[model samples]
Target: MGKTTNALENVFELAYNGKDYAGALGRVKAFHREVAESLAAGAGPYMMADVNEGFRDAFEALEAQLATVSALRDYDEQYDQVVSYGELLASAFVAHVLNDLRPTRWLDCRPLLRTDENWREGLVDWQATEESLRSEVLPRFQEVQTIVTQGFVGGTADGRTTTLGREGSDYTAAILAYCLRAESVTIWKDVAGLLNADPKTFPDTVRYPEISYRETIEMAYYGASVIHPKTLKPLADRNIPLRVKSFLDPAAEGTLIHDCQHPPLAPAFIRKTDQCLLSFSSKDFSFISEENLAVIFGALAQAKLKINVMQNSAISFSVCVDFSERRVHQLLDLLREQFTLHYNTGLTLFTIKNYDAASVARLTEGRRLLLEQRTRGTFQFVCQ
Candidate 1:
């Protein structure tokens, strides 16, 4: 869930099972009013009245939805409906504020970006989306100097809300840039730039001034938290450069990712926590053959489980994947008919790109290593 959705859920919790919905509703209205007042104080009132009316309508619509929902559960329909308000509220606030400075237009992106019915992690319909953008968004861009729209949210054909995935705002930006044929896409972050390791986790992290798209994609694949994993493909395919800039110090050069060579660099450290290690063996005490591997991989794809690291012997095959109880159970149910399964949860998968012996030792020094795999350029460890 997005930050705004989490906050709204907290508000709902405080409201005592919707008995005090007015309190939460009043808070939202007051916040919108405060933002409008702050913007109106500096600029002349050209569209303030209209923007305020729009905000009121939006809030009322949200309130009506909240009144209808009795409880919050894990169902996809209710989950998507509740969490999508985060982006909507954020875009609305930004649009109203920007309109005060100049003639800016607020665009609801749900109508423009079309996707499948997968509510939580929607699959984009590229043909329908591109057509809608050409017909609907391009004309508005020509008319207005600035347009604000919600990210991470799209609409199905029948007009139901859906989200791309968690932390998908970067993917949303990339999608817009690809459709617009943009010169470049800049993602603003709190850090100075893309660092070799997460500064919060490791000390003395070094920032990369520039990196190639392939290297960036590899880093993202290994669980780099700085950029969303799905964000690099579209930009790379179109040969669009992506700049990671600091929002705090905007003047800094930050890091640029383009189609160019990356100089020899230090080892990059990536850590993915809360992992599960699953091992499979043939029930008849036979070798894990090609056919068995094919069935296992197919089931993994069906369950939407990504294997971060894997190793196989003549009799057993072990793999590390992100831990999700529901999905793990789903995968196990499908595989149990043929293979015996054993799993260990609460593990951490660490990856080092361009690693040396010293760096490898540093990571595994005091940890209980469960699995290890190494290649010419990369090394991975699953540790407890």
Candidate 2:
């Protein structure tokens, strides 16, 4: 997301999970109206949709081509075109607003984060990506500019639509900052900044003025909604600093994430509700060895089942995993031939980062805790 007109410096972007696209789009519209009004004093200057009428033809062509492809990888090009609609919408809207106020640039991010054909989670080939950004991207648009672009999406080597993982727009910003070596990257989120815990859950939560990148990564892993897990890896790899600030109050200095030596904050409580835990064992009491685990895990990977925790013994294997419609059913069908499978759904997974005795109690106090595991900085529990 960026400003509508040539006020080139007001670029606001957000990394959001498409899960809430409806709500997100509403936010986009509101922001566009605000930017439009700020720059031009009236909304008439901005065009609602700058698809240029050619958009329909382009979409139809892409759709026709997509209808013919069977393999998932084969649809990369078409996917890129389809998912990029949102970006085009943003850029188009912004450009329309700027048609009079100022000259604005609508940026396409695919050229910057080019990757191999992994489709949805396109594996970014960093060296090539860096070179492309430095050579083609940075030198051209590095100047102070108001650029409107899409996030959570990218293009592939063969020119296909490849989305970064869900909630990937943040990663997109980091990559952009790293490639351009921007002074800093600020993620304009709806909230004030990173809080010690979710304010809704922990009434006493306080915002951390600043936190190290390592801590942010940990929070992301524990299901902290503030930042996407994928968003941190690239920035951390390059040691680039990141800030999460509220779009409403752009002047307020929000939480800063970088390498620092401050004492780590208290354990952060994170809860992922509505999970499923499965327990399995061979009907004939067959030994569960490396080979058996390998076969099971192979199937799991093929189905894209993300396992959170696992514990196995000679006769039985018990594991905690996320609930995915495809993988869960596939795994059960496969295992039923050799083992008796039982699973419990509608369970809650609570993770306390940097756990202490008090933190553990606070998370599991009244819950029917099922499975608990604690380490120096983290404690995970399966609660019903």
Q: Model 1 — TM-score against the truth?
A: 0.86
TM-score of each: 0.86, 0.79
Clash-forming residue pairs, model 2: 5-98, 8-145, 8-146, 46-97, 76-160, 76-161, 77-160, 80-161, 354-377
Residue 114 miss distance in model 2 (angstroms) = 1.7
Best by TM-score: 1
Candidate 2 segments whose C-alpha is farther than 4 A from its true place: 1-84, 98-100, 142-144
Expressed as tens digits, the lDDT of each residue in 111-176 for candidate 1 is 788889876788888878888877877788677889888888888998888888767888888888
Q: Which stretches of candidate 1 lie over 4 Å from their true place?
A: 5-74
Overlapping backbone residue pairs in candidate 1 total: 0
Cα RMSDs of all predictions?
Answer: 3.8, 7.1
TM-score, model 2 to reference: 0.79
